[model samples]
Target: MTRVVGKRAARRAELFDQLVGLFLDEGFAHLTLDDVAARLRCSKSTLYTLAESKDDLVRAATVHFFRRAADEVEEALARVDSGAGDRVTAYLEAVGDQLAPASARFMEDLARMPGARGVYEQNTAIAAERVRTLIAEGVGAGEFRSVSAEFVADVVASTMVRIQQRDVARATGFDDAQAYRELAALVTRGIAR
Candidate 1:
């Protein structure tokens, strides 16, 4: 029974990942449950096993996406054998890379969906806090100049929100991924010792 349950859980996770990939490659707004089922080559019942409704499914998928991205970002940071400042740059660059696969349509769809947008906003806030922690560590280790980590994190958070809202893209003609890369460079250079 335990083996059966484990296999079931594994299949669910795999299906969920496939759903997320489809949503990432193509926005979810235009896709109905039937469309999703058709794309995934699974029945609507299988999707229902993941979430109760289409909106819930989208929200769950968004959460999953961020969770995976966070893991990858940390993994990238772990591979960096440099000082705190370099780790900070690596963290942000990994974030950019994680977001690189998100198409404009997916972003637009996220903006239109309050549930998914909220998830994105929450993750952005979390990322800002992570940045704050990294900055504080750098400052404590004397790898970065003395600066108010909280203030810098607030700025980064605000920019992240703007990036999510497409304001940065509109103003600079840079996509979210590009904006993140630019942000990484700017912040690293600004805080470096």
Candidate 2:
């Protein structure tokens, strides 16, 4: 029984990964269950085991992508033993790297869907708080100049929201990943002692 359960879990995980990759490459806005099943080479029943409906599946995939990205970002940050500035840069660049794989269409679809967008917004808020903590630590450690962590975090969060909304892309002709890279450089230079 345990063996059967483990195999089922592994299969589900494999399907979930394939689904995410498909969604990342091509937007999920137009893909139907039949399309998904055909692309994944699995039955509709197998997709149902992942999510109840198409929207639910998209949300699940978005959640999975963000969760995996967060884990990777933290792992990347952990590898940095340097000062807080380097840590902040590392965190943001890691975020950029994680997001680089997503297509513009996927991002557009994400913004259009409320459930998926909510997950993204929630993650952005959490990331803002994380940035706030990193800035505070930098200040305390004398690695960064005396700047208001709250203010800096608020700025970063606002920029992230704009990036998510596609305003930055429209205005600067930069993708989300490129915008994040520019943001990291700007913030590190702005806050440096």
Candidate 3:
């Protein structure tokens, strides 16, 4: 994973953002240095200016993408929504937004890559903890049912993982984003007092 610190980190982030969509369209395993360069409209030498190998490039890009995603989700949580429920829903939607454009193949590739999977797992866990905090706040405000926030938080996190599964999406005819919307609705209603 790229430390993403130091001079010209903004330039590095900009480059990573440009490549994220390409990687999501054609997973790391399928994309070669030539393919990346072609898609990026840059030369292999320019890519080497960022990373030494293809694998390193992918790892850094994945990490950088997820880091930006987490920041967005946190920003969503901090917004002054209509209510705590809305805030939570916005946060969940933000989570979905992170991978809104990722293809199923991209998801499968993520599972196959340990480093990428770690970034995904860590983000989900953070989302889960944030959900727990919101749930407790809602309950305290008498806006949500007085339920076990921790348990429900765990369920929300697990549901997030399940929503990303290809089989679940195929069986339900809901893409990851749709699955998240439905799940958010279910959770909001399920916990509503």
TM-score of each: 0.97, 0.98, 0.87
Model 2 vs. true fold: TM: 0.98
- Residue-level lDDT of model 3, residues 30-119, one tens digit each, is 889998988888899878988898877887788887888888878876775688789778878877877788888788888778777777
Clashes of each: 0, 0, 0
- The alpha-carbon deviation from the true structure for residue 67 of candidate 2, after best TM-score superposition, in angstroms, is 0.8
lDDT of 2 by residue, 1-193 (tens): 9999999989988888898899989989999999999999999998888989999999999999999999999999999999999999999889888989989999999999999999999999998899999999999999999999999999999999998988999999898899999999999999999
The C-alpha stretches of model 2 lying farther than 4 A from their native spots are: none
Q: What lDDT score belongs to each candidate, Candidate 1 first?
A: 0.92, 0.93, 0.81
Question: Candidate 3: where is the Cα deviation over 4 Å?
Answer: 1-7
Model 1, stretches more than 4 Å misplaced? Answer: none
**Shift of residue 66 alpha carbon in model 1, Å:** 0.7
Q: Write the per-residue lDDT of candidate 1 for residues 1-193, one digit (tens) a residue.
A: 9999999999988987998899989999999999999999999998999999999999999999999999999999999998887888898889889999998889989988999999999999999999999999999999999999999999999999999998998899898889999998999899888
Clashing pairs in 3: none
TM-score of 3: 0.87
TM value for model 1: 0.97
Give the CA lDDT, 0 to 100, for residue 121 in model 3. 77
| TM-score order of candidates, top first | 2, 1, 3
